[model samples]
Target: MKVFLAIAAKVRGTGVERAMAVARRSIGAAFPVPAEEVTHEEWREPGAALLAWTNEPGPAITYAAGVSGYLADPRDLPAAAAGDLGLGGCYSLFTCRSAATGPTGADPVYHAETPELHVYGSRALLVHLVATGGRVEHDPLALQSMVRQGYFLSDETPFAGVRALPPGHRITAGRAEPYGLAEPTDLASALVASVRGIEGTARLTLTGGRDSRLIAATLHAAGIPFTAVTYGTQDNPDVILARKVARRLRVDHQVIAPKPVTPDDTATRVAEVLRTCEGMTSAYENVAPHTPFRARPSLGGHGGEILRGGFLLGCQDHRRKLDALFLGNLDLLTAEAAEHARGLAESWQPTPETLDHLYLRYRVGRWHAAARAGIQRSGLRIQPFLDHRVVTAALAVDPAERATQGLVHGLIAELAPALARVPFEARRWPWSKPAQKTPDWRSEPGDALKSAILGSRELAAIVRLDRVEPLLYGPRLPKPALVWHLATVATLLRPMRMAVAA
Candidate 1:
């Protein structure tokens, strides 16, 4: 397992060398693998290119977290061309306008960053790559899109010029193209086999949901030993159902409740998350259950929704699902900003499966903050849903079945009846919302956030600080949403240098 950092641009210079240092610091790869063992590729002709091992990669094929793909290939590290790249799995640093040159010739500028190319001019790029490798600074439109439609929603990143590589496309020397994939196999069996391929005992995250239960059934059928865990408030049905499933399977189970969050603790934690993850997307997973399984391979239900249409109720049109999705979430923006967010949504292609794939790419597979990144913090986080086997099988399913996740439910009901009997966590959504708490919005966290937003001379110029105060205060929405948005605004607006210096 290896995770490497790659930087390529039109002209070779000190910027590339400096990027290597940033990569090491960014990945926290303290020990170099000795110069001789390190892999290096430099292409001088087409605007120089450079690829170096950043901290050793964890696995040769790190599964794409929220999508059906892999980062590095089994055939080679730093895949040679677009065809070799995985579908919708890449983040490159380069400067190429329309029609990138053959292998890419010297462009006007040199850019560098990871997860995705950060092209918000020099300061924004430096803050994300060097200041805090996790989150990137956004321009006005980017900030508005995030505040309203959710972060990482449009191909538009917070930065200008830098674009996300759409699912199924690859970037090679700044050249990008889509590659067709071979068909996948039996997803249920594939889930088990994928875990077996990893040399170790596996731990599963059992939830009051079809995805986790489905995986548990498949793993049980294959005779793989695993420990199941559920964490959150005790009253959460997911905790109860997960326990019931674990008991039926005769597997060890643990239920952990969330720890109390102090204002200072939250600020620091949120700061770290906002900086590491692509957006303000984050949740505090109880560390207690994870402690016992820290060293073992853990499996999650990431990307399972690819088989289920997302919270897309009332969205009838193919091309305008993005608009529906934006509307589905709460409104925390000015009328102008909300409209701007809506405009960004309209840019979505009118494909039937557009939202499904976009959700996978932008929300899940984009970065580490969630289970994808949690694996980095915890043990090896493996999501069987992202396995090619599951992806292939899922695509073959009829769209209608996928919409209701009929396939997943059927699989569980047949293979794991006990799990099927339990009430689903989502079933209560219509009648029940999580108890929303009103926090002291004018207190420490709020003041800190206010200062952060106001301090960012760049972001404040466009984003009206007046509007930010109202949307972030009490009664606007749920506490969790309010907390996260504050973290997002603060993290994105505050420059890394200022954050650190303060």
Candidate 2:
């Protein structure tokens, strides 16, 4: 939460006043700072720092760490610090801005190279901040992991000096450990409070998914007026089920189709999403969903999986098989790099709590949150599931409630039985077929995909470009997910090309 602004740092050609405002609004703290002076809590440290946006007031850990709800009991920190840290209710992004002079003592300096952009930093800051010319040198391993799959084995970012603190884990005096995972309070009341907090022209995105449905039921019970919206093709399962949900709740609903897309249009939109996502995930055609909503701070369901065990629906729970299985679609990688990435996953500390923590940090935080960012840009208000109160409750609840999505079912059936009586639709798409039990990507080959892969310097250099011949010319690749990554990688590289041009 502490911000160290370099001397003469200007975010988007503005003084500290505007830059500081951007940072405050990002985390939902809006205290006014009248001058371009150092923040009070920041004075506890040497550099320009802002007090972290947290409810609990405690000593900020001397090591690189941030806490959200309850700072785990201090007695627990020393013992758990050595493992993969997942402090259940904390979040922090960190970097050591020194040149590569590894390990002055016990702690090695973390490399950070993201250019100064907004007061609130993000991956997309590069496209805007780097144009006039700050170039960030990325680690090769980090770049490959982001492009080939979705995340790197460690917390490394594309820019060398920057690394994020993995959730549920925090550092103290250069040591890292597992943040305590258990929360004493359950999530039911917290979730309801989250829904009730929305006021003044509020909106919700209702997919056929349980998270959205639960939120809808809660809103109905609370007597809150919200207009639920669904966007996709007319027959898409989300659209249809959301319709049933709206009708049953007796609330207003709206549907927004993707404006017609051309290859060029797809390229433009994909690049926009990549800018916000920091090239961590790909953009699909879902970009038009938010245009119809004029509401501020739209609600979304992000951490629903934490309660449902959604990430590993059927995959083996252990590390080896999960490593092989999660990376199954990325055949485009050369044998060598692919093996290294798999090796990393294999060694990943395996536990349900740890797995859930990482999934929330990377998959939902980076990939899903980034996708939502791509869709709404600045439109989305908040995702209650990711909130600190929500996280604390989820981590604290009994494990049995999470299995088979029992938590979701229990809450809805208890809160709004009529809505639950209407069975959940089995299909998640417009016209899904068994197709050997995989997502059906058997649509005719897309020219946009081929163009995206072939037209960029960054994609050509990193991927075994020669290995992608099948995708570009010879045959239809059956995986929609793989195609998406390729398109996203292509979109991320466009800015690199533009940097060259200007």
Candidate 3:
């Protein structure tokens, strides 16, 4: 088992160095491996300094700890607790100068120095840890004590086969269950149960989306004390609708504005965020390019996709019509590619095989696998949507009820009029406007040239190809491939020479 940790903090003169030293000492005491430190030069692009350690030929457990002056939302505490408690075998700690600046591209970035740590070995382990915010403690007596108090147990990672949580633990809503099986009333009751099970503060994510709104409504109906948070540009529909819903519920609401990402900064920042996420299910998962971590246990509404069915149901319907139309009209070349694509498409049909594959192959299965590896490496348990019962219910719902047009969850809103009243409107913000209007740089010749100069060969090697081939020359690439291409282009355009130097 190998363990790695990255810490970020602002430099407070000599005190920052002392803090780093102390953090290293604490980590070393908890793990058997020797730690290594890598300090960033002042002018470096990703300026965050890092300390990493790996354990080999030993137990698969890895521990990581990050300390920042920035205060996180109390709701995120469970995740923090889980990450910290899980420290054993191998450990890494990251100490930043200050939390005021948060984690910006130029402000001594961390994680870019290492990327492979983000891969999780198991999805179930990752989901369980993130959802509960609990880790397997080293002390059996202590673990037993926490369990007696109602903490949950978690063991969804690859390295360590088993993990335990203290009593009163709760999983995030989206990851709780499949979309359709649970009735609105049942979901609401589950939310209430999760809240009641926890001691002290709880945070609820409120968005214009029905799932979040429903959760908030349920919390209110249950008289649970919670802080509601919404993030986006001010004009985003979610921001607008969330505000309205918060007002109606008369709960405290906090709105986070989206940050701006220039062509020069996007790739590095995305990579860093991904590294921090380490245990996420999707390679595309990020904490919004601009927004820094503000609070913990950030309630994510990712389960909405399952609740409404996968995002591609409508496209599937459209393809079915197109297939009928083009039965004999399409050329052989197009037909061959379409044949393969069609099989992939048809695999998503609402059937036992499709449902099982969706859950095991993509949804929980893959997600948990990625998450397990990431959590071990980064020590950050990212619980996006880990409500199991809710997800199971969603899976049981008929496919017709899970509309591609966002009508399925919408129908649920109709069933619960009060839920429909919760506001969920998308709004655009001033800062985001410029980027939205800016032409994609990958289409520009200058960007392409820059890419060729800044180690295109290396990029090619990472991609396992002798040359950068045009997509038009081969079979159509998958969506993930397209995103990686864009990301590679972004990386080339933004040379980290200056950022790394600082």
**What is candidate 1's lDDT per residue for 142-228, written digit by digit as tens?**
666454434546545555445545444445545556546545566565555545544456878788877788878877776778888
lDDT-best of 1 and 3: 1
| Candidate order (TM-score) | 1, 2, 3
Q: Rank the candidates by lDDT, best first.
A: 2, 1, 3
Best by lDDT: 2
Determine which window of 10 residues in candidate 1 has minimal summed lDDT: 99-108
- Model 2's lDDT to the true fold? 0.49
TM-score of each: 0.69, 0.66, 0.46
Which residue ranges in model 3 land beyond 4 Å of their true spot? 1-185, 233-235, 264-296, 316-356, 367-385, 404-417, 422-502
Worst 10 residues of 2 by lDDT: 98-107
Q: What is the per-residue lDDT of model 3 for residues 236-278, given as tens digits with 9 covering 90 to 100? A: 6787788887777678888998656334344454354333332
lDDT of 1: 0.47
How accurate locally, in lDDT, is each candidate? 0.47, 0.49, 0.34
